[model samples]
Each structure stands twice: as structure tokens, then as C-alpha cells.
Target: MARFLTLLVLLLAIDRAFACKPEQHFNANFSDTADQLSGTEAGNLATWVKSLQNDYSNHDLFVISSYVKNASQPGDSAERRTKWLKDFLVAAGEDENSIVSAGTQVYKPENFFYTKITPSTLIIEFVPGCPNPCCLGANPVKEK
Candidate 1:
């Protein structure tokens, strides 16, 4: 029984690490400007995030922003883009803790299996995870 239980636990761990994939929500061409999000953009983003959270009440929320490398201005960088998004989300009444700022990375659509993608586009990916209190021994269960 001990050997069988050990094997089961190992298999389950492997499955969680490899078999389970994060559900990515793409906001293609979320922005044409690398500076900041417009009022409408911020509002829409907040509304969408909130709705998703409401629906997946048990899953944690994370935000990732990918921007066009060639579109950045002389003073612009990935960090700045991330800050812009974070500020916009905060201003829109989104809990800062709930938001994860994935620092600016090259907007590579090929990595996402897209052949044609716009320049200066920002892709926001939402990944689910266990919350703080439930981190230990808690399995992520997707809501219907």
C-alpha cells in the first residue's frame, strides 16, 4: 500500500506540473501606444478581469503584458510598459495584489502559434493558481 500510494503521489505531481496547462486570455493589440492605457481601455480591462474573477472565484488572477520591441520609444522599456498597465489597473479599482505585472517581453506571436500579429500590441495572459491561504495541498479546480 505504501509503494502504491507513493507512486500515485508522484504521478499526481507530474500531472499537475506538466499535464495541466494555464488558460491564457489574449488581449491582442490591446494597445497601439506603449505609454499608457486610455480611460476606455482601463475600464474595459478592469471589467473583463472582474468578470473572470467572479466566474472563477477560486482561481487566482495574473496579468502578463507583451509589447512590440521595435515600437518602444527612446525612453520606453518593458518595465515602463508593465508599470503603465499596473497603474491603469490600480486606477480602475483593481486590487494591486490581484494583478501580476509580467515585465515587458518581445511580442512574439509565433510563440503563441500566430503567424500575423500587429506591432505595438500587448497580450494579456490570465493564469489560474491557488490563493495564499489555500496554497498548501490545494488542487486548482476550474469553475464551470
Candidate 2:
């Protein structure tokens, strides 16, 4: 019994360490954008978004993922990432209608700079708190 308990504790700790801090990851920084969510910084914000779709999740609460950035990339696009996020959420057994995407391109005309990043955000509503949410209605994920 002691051995089992120790193993369980160790497993739980490992999971937490790897999983993203849901609360902070979905923060309404009102300043964060998706373009800036990547890389090692931002607490690995992009990965946190991915963690929400973990199969082991069982929280009866809504999740809102917001993407932000500092500037716009002429070739930058969130469509691909957005699709991945949707797929991730569905795979995690989350309802397909809870993902909320919001943000606008940064106006950086005539700026050919990789550093000219345009922020964006992706909000996944795990347990929606809003009435008449504009996103797709929550529904069980359909196995493909």
C-alpha cells in the first residue's frame, strides 16, 4: 500500500509539473496575443493551450484561450494553429463548440522584419460562463 501511494504521488506531481497552469494560461491579460504565445518564454503559453486538451482533464469549468502579440507578421497566420487547437480540444473529449477566437492584425505597414510580430489569441471555453456564447455550442467530440 505504501508503495502504491508513493507511486501515485509521484505520478501526480509529474503531471502537474508538465501541465500548463490553466488559470494563468487563459488569463485575460487583455494584453496577450497568440503570436506572442510561442517560444520558451510566456511560460510556454502555447504549450499550456495544448495542455487544456489533455485526455485526463475533468474540470467542470470553462476555459478561455486568448492569443496576443506585439506586432503583425505579413506572413503570419493563426489559421493552422487554430485548427490544431480545435483538434486538440476535441481529442481531449471537450465539446467542439467551446472555442472562442478573437483579435486583430497589428498595423505594421512597410515593415519587413521578423521581429515585427503581430499578436493574436485563441480562447477555448471549457465551461462557459456567458449566456448566448457566440462560439459553437458545446458537444461531445466525435471520434474519427
lDDT of each: 0.60, 0.44
What are the runs in model 1 whose C-alpha is more than 4 Å off? 1-17, 28-31, 37-44, 58-61, 71-81, 112-117, 131-140
TM-score of each: 0.55, 0.32
32-95: candidate 1 lDDT, tens digit per residue: 5546666776677777767756655444565756555544544254556666666765665556
Best by lDDT: 1
The lDDT, on a scale of 0 to 1, for candidate 1 is: 0.60
Least well predicted 10-residue stretch by lDDT in candidate 2: 128-137
RMSD of 1: 4.8
**Reference-based TM-score, model 1:** 0.55
What is the per-residue lDDT of model 2 for residues 5-48, given as tens digits with 9 covering 90 to 100? 99999998777556623232343222233433343434454455
TM-score: which candidate is best? 1
